[model samples]
Target chain A: AQSVTQLDSHVSVSEGTPVLLRCNYSSSYSPSLFWYVQHPNKGLQLLLKYTSAATLVKGINGFEAEFKKSETSFHLTKPSAHMSDAAEYFCVVMLTGTASKLTFGTGTRLQVTL
Target chain B: EAGVAQSPRYKIIEKRQSVAFWCNPISGHATLYWYQQILGQGPKLLIQFQNNGVVDDSQLPKDRFSAERLKGVDSTLKIQPAKLEDSAVYLCASSLSPEADTQYFGPGTRLTVL
Candidate 1:
């Protein structure tokens, strides 16, 4: 009943430049959106979340995402990309009524260059 | 606080072979979840447990997979007869509150079947 879509399979950016990873979702109820990052051979880490209370959510490592109800999107954006930011990013969606059952998008691999 | 921990970071097995992976979530985390991430894909929730009780397992490959969280702390996932298509990284995540749904993930067990 709920689904997320990562529009870009890959996003390449240079260090110190802005990074953008697009994501969209469809849910019958009000949706909670999240962004998670995964380094090679590592687990996914929470980047940011939009709990419906705030449209613009700030997360660790200077990452942020804006939840747009009109567009049905919650795209992740960072002012600058660090070399350490090279990793795979995921878009997740869930319904508050469901109690932590999350739906994940395919993924977006970010390649940060020097 | 320590993050989620998983054992047997990597495992290789032949078709129809059985295998199991273990996970220890963060201390005091009441909600635990199991997910499968195929290469190039995001983590997919296979099961969710809240204090020793199952909340969801709709996406789980019930025919080939089984899991338990008896003590409501540590958990395990087993594949009775893995197929080549079963290769993936098994991720374990935990959250403080089931309703909040901000999950922290483990490094995961990568299983490769030939």
Candidate 2:
């Protein structure tokens, strides 16, 4: 079984400040991880993914995440938060088999304050 | 390339009413998935399809939900006798293949069961 846990249900940050959203996972297989952002009334957009290539993965909109195996974590980070960055972010784990299935975390709602 | 598309962006119905949602994935994609996202929560996979065949429906509420993919292209999900708890956004995502890590999502159909 594979599952993801978002440590923070909500995170508030001032514009231009650093942003961090913590996530952890449990999986039996090697596991493929992903970060997705959802703007209100919009579909989910893939931010980045870790497929065993790099420990630190860079995504669009200046977002990035580091996969830490020892910590069982994949925390998303942005150098600076922008008003446009305010959205709900989800951590997902992909389970491999005959078909791949994704398990999502509860999500972290990032609020960028002016 | 066009992204995934879904019909009936929003729907409201009383308890026990039946509702269905349609999804058209990206062209040439062979894997499709259905997910349910409750307000303030993450998306949960309801079913997955490889081509027109079902790969997984382990998390689907079989008693109330059913889904089908025709010609390995468009797909439909139906809910019979929906409950108030069924109020959520139904997301449809597709990947190039089962092994692909990235899944492009549609805007989703929000269903509210009063």
Candidate 3:
């Protein structure tokens, strides 16, 4: 079984400031981690994933995440935030090999301000 | 590549009514998924299919919800006697395979149960 926890339900970041969203997971075996962003009335878009190949993963729209095995964490970050970045972000986890099922965290609503 | 496609962007129904949502996965994508996302919450897996075979439906409300992937290319999710609590956005996603741990999603159908 696998599960994910998003540390925050809401995160506010100023435009041009750094953005960070924390996530943790519990899995018996190695797990695949992902970050997805959803704007209002939009579909969920894949941001990045960590699947044992690389500890640091970069994605589109200036987003990135690093996997920490020791801490069981996959936190998303952005060097600078833009207004377009304001959206709901989700942390999802899949089983090690099969990736048959995905467990989603109770997403964090990101608010970017000027 | 074209992303997943879904029909009826929005629907309104009253309690004890029925509703259905359709999905067409990306071409040649063998794996498809259905998720329910309530406002302010994350998307929850409802069902999954791999080439016309059901992979999982543990979280689906079997008493009132039924889904099918008739041809292994397109799928449908139906909810009967929908309750007020059933109001949510139904999202469809597809992937090449579970091993990839990457999924592309559709715009999703919003259902409001009055």
Candidate 4:
């Protein structure tokens, strides 16, 4: 079974500081990884996705994630945190040939403050 | 392009009652999916449809939960005899095809079972 484990249940960062959300994966084979963000009372938005093409994936809102195969990790990062960046982040995995069935990790809530 | 659309942004009902949520996928999207997101948890796939045909529903609780995309465009998810555990946000998403990696999401329908 393909699954992702979010290392932190909550992360707090001051405005303009760097932010990191850790995630580890357990998959039998190479898998598609994704980062999604959800604000309160809003729908989930795809932050980024990592297929086999590239290890470093850039996403909207100045966010990016690096897929480290050897480490079995895909961690989301941002150079500067903003108040708008406060939201719940999820790490998701999609196994090949599954017709887009996604397995999501328990989310990590981000809190950005001045 | 318009994103996925869902009706009745919020619903409240008593346990053992029934409720339904509706979704309209993006224009020309051939794949639709329903996901249940409990508070503090990432969304879980409940079902997937490929052009009006059920592609995957392994995780759905068929005894109490049902869903259908009758015309391959709009979809509906029904929960009969709702349980308190069933209270969660129901999210609808769609992609251009079953193999598409990016899925657009709609503002979810929040259901509360008393």
Candidate 5:
């Protein structure tokens, strides 16, 4: 079985400061990874996805993530944070095979403060 | 295009009562998925459908939970004799196809079992 672990349960960053959310994965085979964000009362929105194409994946809202196969990590990062960036983020791993089930990590709540 | 659509943004039902949720996927999407997300935990796949056929339902609790996608466009999930543990957010997502990597999500229906 494949799974993802979000190291931080909550992250706080000041406006204009950098933000980082850590995630690690455990999968028997090469896996596809994704980052999704959910604002208050909103649906989950895809931030980016890594499908063995590019190691550095750029996503919407100036967010990005790097897929490091060596460390089995795909951490989300932003050069600068904004007040609107506050939301819950999820790290997901797509299970290999037919069904292509997605295994999500315990979300990390991000708080952007002024 | 319009994203996935789910009805009843929030629902409250007594224990042992039955509840149902509906979802309408994006136009032209050939695959749909249902997930259960407990508070403070990640979303887990409960079922998957390709068009109007069932693809993977191994994780779904068949005794209490049942889902169907008729005409391959609209879907419904029902839980009979709901339990406290079943109180969670039910999310619906759809992709262009089973091979498509991007799966757009709908605003989840939050279920609270009293």
Candidate 6:
């Protein structure tokens, strides 16, 4: 079984300040984790992924995430939040092997206030 | 390259009405997925197809939901007698292959039931 949990239901960050969205996961086998951002009325865009490669992964639009095995977490981070960064973010876990199913977290709504 | 495409960006219907959504994956992508995202919740997998073959439909409400991926390129999902609870956003995503973890998503179709 694979599952993900986003620690915060909503996060408020000021523009030009740092941003952090915490996520945790549980998987039976080697897991693949992903962070996706969805702007209002827009598609879910890939922010970053952790597939047992680098613990720290950089993504588009100045986003990044760190995979901490001992913590069982993959939290998204950005040095500075922009007004355009306000959106809903999801943490997903993919089950390995034949099932290849993805389990999504409840999501965290980030509100960037200027 | 062009991203995944979906039609009928918005739909409004009454209870018991039937509806369908269409999706066109990115060129050369062999894995397709349909996800349902309820308001305030993360996207949930509805069905998955690999080269026109059904890979997973466990989370799909098979009694009313049906999907098909013909020619391993285009796909469609249908819901007969949709209930009020079925109102949500339907998201389409595609990956390069069955084992690929990162996925590109479409803008999604928002369905409103009355």
- The lDDT for every candidate, in the order shown, is 0.92, 0.95, 0.92, 0.94, 0.94, 0.92
Model 3 interface CAPRI class: medium
lDDT string, candidate 3, A1-114, tens digits: 789999999999999999999999999988889999999989999898888888999999989999999999999999999999999999999884564787899999999998
Which CAPRI category fits model 4?
A: medium
The TM-score of the first chain in every model comes to 0.96, 0.98, 0.96, 0.97, 0.98, 0.96
lDDT of 3 by residue, B1-114 (tens): 788999999999999999999999999999999999998888899998888998888999999999999998999999998999999999999999866578899999999999
Off by over 4 Å in 5: none
- Number of colliding residue pairs in each model: 0, 0, 0, 0, 0, 0
Per-residue C-alpha lDDT of model 4 across residues B1-114, encoded as one tens digit per residue: 788999989999999999999999999999999999998888999999999999999999999999998888999999998999999999999999988988899999999999
TM-score of each: 0.96, 0.97, 0.96, 0.98, 0.98, 0.97
Candidate 6 docking category? medium
Candidate 6 regions exceeding 4 Å error are none
The root-mean-square deviation over C-alpha atoms between each candidate and the true structure, in angstroms, is: 1.1, 0.9, 1.2, 0.9, 0.9, 1.0
Once superposed on the true structure, which residue ranges of model 4 sit more than 4 Å away at CA? none
**Which candidate has the top score in DockQ?**
2
**Which residue pairs collide, candidate 4?**
none
Instruction: Give Cα distance to truth, residue B114, candidate 6, Å.
Output: 0.8
Give the per-residue lDDT of model 6 (tens digit) for A4-76.
9999999999999999999999987778899999999999998888888999999999999998889999999
The better-scoring model by TM-score among 1 and 5 is 5
Model 2 vs. true fold: TM: 0.97
Candidate 2 structure quality by residue, lDDT tens digits, B19-75: 999999999999999999999889999999999999889999999999999899999
Model 6 residue A101 distance off true place after TM-score fit, in angstroms:
1.7
- Considering chain A alone, report the TM-score of candidate 1 relative to the true chain A: 0.96
For model 5, how does the per-residue alpha-carbon lDDT over A1-114 read when each residue is reduced to its tens digit? 789999999999999999999999999988999999998888899999999998999999999999999999999999999999999999999965666788899999999999
- Worst window of 10 by summed lDDT in candidate 6 chain B: B95-104
Of candidates 6 and 4, the better by TM-score = 4
